[model samples]
Target chain A: MLKLPSVPGGAPPRPGTPAAEPASLKDNASEAAISALGWLDERTAISGTARWVMFRKVPKGTNWFYTLGTSTMMAFLSQVVTGVFLAMYYDPSPNNAYESMRHINNDVFLGQFVHGMHRWGATTMVVLIFLHMGRTFFFGAYKYPRELNWVIGVILVLLTMIMALTGYLLPWDQRSYWATAVGVNVFASAPIAGPYLGDFLRAGPEFGATTLSRFYAIHMLLLPGLIGGLIAAHLYLVIKHGTTAPPWIEAEIDEDLRKSEA
Target chain B: MPDTSKNTSPYTADRNIPGAFEGETVTRRRFMTGAAHATNGIAVGMIALPAIGFALGPNFKKLEERWEAVGRPDEFSPTEYISRTITVVAGAGETGKTTVYLRERNPDIDHEPEDEYNQYIAISTRCMHLGCPVRYVPASQRFICPCHGGVYDFLGEVQGGPPVRPLDRFYTRVKDGLVELGPRFSVNSELKRFSPRDPAQDLDALGQYLFPSRPTIRKIPGT
Candidate 1:
């Protein structure tokens, strides 16, 4: 008969042996935690999903480079958290946007830190995404069945860039205004539909009353939803296909198979 | 259940489905599925179409033309360009206000055929390169963009750098002794008038056809 391990710590004593008393508060706490987890798991069966996502079989030669995607995701999560809090104080109106940003930086408690995290986290996320993409390319991880994942990743990259561009104008300062103007003009540089696209971005022929608010909606609402959704798809594919082995690590033929062939 | 697999007929009645009307091509099950799908599509569209239209509504909206008086006709000089601040967009406070360079039309330099709107040349400070505000340097008699080094001559023609065309100009009309700057209009390399276009949209030849005028704002016809 197979003996299953006990949940808390050690295996139960033999049937004839004397039962031991549970010792220490730590053991009781761990036992309580385990039972709670089991209780939840019994109803939801969520542990299987957690196990499936977290305990994936990574390919051989997995190294520090493999962490870049997770690092990028972490950076994005940091941006999301910081951005949510920042939105509480941000005023999208052109009349108050600069003043509100000042209030956030100078008046609100920990506002500067949260705002700084979001601002810097954006750059960190961009850099990390590029590094992750470079890793996938250099390792040739984008081949075969993983091509769809690569396409999804490219879309994510575009979404991230849009997030950056739209988010830039939230500050409502001279630089933000000018940079966005230049950026929209770049969009207008495209032939045929470019002019209409520019109008769509500006919400008019010129940057008007709603331009700042438009950018705010895109930055905080539209883009985050899209980026987050695409990221979920990207990660689902990543887990489904597992990961590619480092290109430097070549396959080794079995000695028996080689001998038979010889 | 009837053994109808071998029938493979086009009509439900031919297939021997129970309660099927004669000559009915569509099965009740297929019709129900299509109805449910259509109902779902309509429901989704009811929510989605309005939201999409709400977002894109601004593209087709035409803004009202605004004219702001900058100075009296005598205040402007034909030989020298003077800067005047005017509101390009309302309700945006100082952000909407832009600097326009105003001067009386000098026939020696201004070759474009004279009209009621062009008697006083009102040059838009918006750089033709990338929409950066260009400053008129009195010493050099040139409009210079600080951001990208785009230079335009006194006539607002692209003199150097990456400017695709001349700096945009506004309609000038002397209303009640005051020179009023009206809606902006873009000019091609030959200084011919066209609807206002965003900076970097070249107005030369095929450029106009490639980058069509937006529906939101248009130049006054027969001006």
Candidate 2:
């Protein structure tokens, strides 16, 4: 029941006239795109979901600050893409890890660029996620019915920190090695369960052969799956309960309702 | 309506279900559901338990006690320290190796009780604060940690900084004309030897009981 926009003053020719009229290339392209989308929508019956997700009724006074969550997601997506490529060349063994990184920097095409994106994107994601958290806090969006979402957000922040910590050791250079040593020792500094937890993280009492591989598995496989699942839940809750307007936006009183109450 | 609340009898037939056997206690449907749940639980446990054990098995595994000979006894002096690279973990190339400062035991300065393992003193470079490698500077006669500001004097006791205890030491013995370093052992403020603990785990008072030694690495028995 959908109609395409008609060409201005370009009505169909009479049946008796020559059938040489051609549709515009733009019109043909749009028609093909729309038909492809329509065919997919028919088989999947997904138009309703698409409309529901895309055409959300955001609150009044939604501003640029609301985009911080999306920005953070973009940063996370960059990290995921670049991390996948980096893992293709990275060696997780203690002996070859540093050498493989040097190879990535020197030999692989656009390796340093992608590696830099992942490195800097990690920082960007942390910054943007915190900024998004700040926006939610300052705007009082974490109150009332959205408290579960806030808790989930806090957990996501923790998982992000775990991602950062685990990813830092994958390079296996001297800085990464010593930094992880210090970091794991920090874990061991705890009173009761510290030593066991350190062993778990390092896969042994000392930073043995398996530590880099363990960190790689944690960083890429375990954490990404957890973060992806949590992000889906986060967006679901966000869509379920629409965003809050800025606190400065007072509720507008309806004159007719006021008169009726009076 | 029937008084179903009163139907607490053990037999299913007493509940008056259609086609219920006379002596049947549980219905086939309930039994099947319970069996299905039990089977699912066993299946899940079969996969999950082994996977968890694979990751955590190293924590409970005891490491092999290794003693590597650093050098001859004449190479070490009591006044100054000599560095020797020793392998703590096997199979790992450079990461497994750590530098130990070795010197002959000075009778006046070394006050710990003399034993078969104390002929030469071997000090672990691992800082007591957060496990960063501390470098011994001959100029100041002080061990300085580059990561943190932990400082230790010639005796490897905490002099000034954030180190919780003294630098850890290795058990040493003279065997076949070569000075060999044995298993690592941690010390308290009084330099009393306990089991080998990770750096930053204090051994003073309740600190020993609080941060217990791992089963993977330990000091020699009766030491």
Top of the candidates by lDDT: 1
Models 1 onward score TM values of: 0.94, 0.93
Worst 10 residues of 1 chain A by lDDT: A1-10
How many angstroms is residue A245 displaced in model 2 relative to the true structure, after the best TM-score fit? 1.2
**Index of the highest-TM-score prediction:** 1
lDDT of 1 by residue, B67-162 (tens): 998888889899999999999888887788889999999999889899899999999998988899899999999999999899999999999999
What are the per-residue Cα lDDT tens digits for candidate 2 across A209-249? 88888998999999999999999999999988988989999
Provide the DockQ value for model 2: 0.76
What would the per-residue lDDT of candidate 1 be over residues A59-173, giving only the tens digit for each residue? 6799999999999999999999999999899988889999999999999999999989999999999999999999999999999999999999999888899899999988889
The residue ranges of model 1 lying beyond 4 angstroms of the native Cα positions read A1-24, A254-262, B8-10
lDDT of each residue in B97-119, candidate 2, tens digit only: 99999999999999989999998
For each candidate, the alpha-carbon lDDT, in order, equals: 0.90, 0.90
Off by over 4 Å in 2: A1-28, A255-262, B1-6
